[model samples]
Target: MSEVYDRLRGEIVDGTFETGAQLVELALAERYGTSRTPVREALRRLEQDGLVERGDRGMRVRTRSPEEILEIYEVRISLEATAASAAAQRHSEFDLIRIRRAQAAMDSTSTDDPAAMAAANRAVHEAIWVASHNGTIVDLLTRLNNHLTRYPATTLKVQGRWAEALDEHRALIDAIEQRDAARAHDLARDHMTKARDLRLQIYREDPTA
Candidate 1:
């Protein structure tokens, strides 16, 4: 049941089962080569996780509204900025190595592979949160990130945004490495602000998005 839950959650997060798409238990069971029992259990867990919800037709992926997106980003910016400041003050060599490795992976990935880039981007952010050593902040940020997965389009896929984001990340990493808490905090906030602006623009341009 846990295996089924993990696989289903991964698919939803990776955009295999898009927002508002029906999640048919029998179909999922067939896809996973299991009985409907496990699939049913998985769907219940996913609902508890807020990834899916019951609808008139059946269970469907949860979609975030524009207002919800804005609220999430506002909270994320505050928490991430605090995390960056704390990480700059307390990070270890191992923490820096993890962050740099994630950045390196992002740099090596082609923009054409948005999923890989997004995953690498997540790695870098999660590394910073871990470096902060604050369980509360990490838990909140993790939930926000999960909510973000409901969006079908990644900001990295926006034209020319990938390069700009890379440069911003480089500057952020530099600030953190230098133990400049103020600089790290500001840079992290600015990065998220830019991302929010870009995402809003994309949403405005594509109503269906």
Candidate 2:
């Protein structure tokens, strides 16, 4: 059941099972070479995980409204700010190293590949969350981030966002390294605010976004 659930979740994330697509138990069972029982269990778990929702017919990949997406981003902005503040106050040298490395990875990613750049950006954020050393904040952020993956499109694709975001990230690192919690909080909050606006713009420009 766990294996089925993991695979299904990955499929959802990678767009193999698109948003609003039906999750037919028998079809999925045949596709995975498993009985309907495991597929059924996986669907239930996915529903609980907010990756699937019950519809008029059956479970389908969940889709958020624009309002809901904005709400999630608002919550994320607050949480990310808190995480950055905490990280500045408490992060170890090794934590700083990890965050820097993640940023370096982003810098090395090809400019033509927005998807790869976006993934590397996610890695940088993940490292910052871990550096916060607050388990509750980290867990909340991870779950919120999962909700965000439904959008699929990267804000880095917005004109000049890739370069601008990298500059913001560098500022964040400097704040954290300087142990300026207040500055770090402000930088993170501003960073997320820009990202939220850019993403909504992306969604407007492209229906798939």
Best by lDDT: 2
Against the reference, the lDDT scores of all candidates come to 0.88, 0.90
Off by over 4 Å in 1: 14-18, 22-37, 55-58, 207-209
| Candidate 1 Cα lDDT to native | 0.88
- Pairs that clash in candidate 2: none
Candidate 1, 65-109: lDDT as tens digits:
778779989999999999999999999999999999999988998
Cα lDDT tens digits for candidate 2, 1-46: 8888889999998889887999999999988889999999999878
Measured against the true structure, the TM-scores of the candidates, in listed sequence, are 0.84, 0.93
Clashing pairs in 1: none
Q: Which candidate tops TM-score?
A: 2
What clash count goes with each model? 0, 0
Q: After superposition, how far is residue 180 of candidate 2 from its true place, in Å?
A: 0.9
TM-score for candidate 2:
0.93
How many residue-pair clashes does candidate 1 contain? Answer: 0
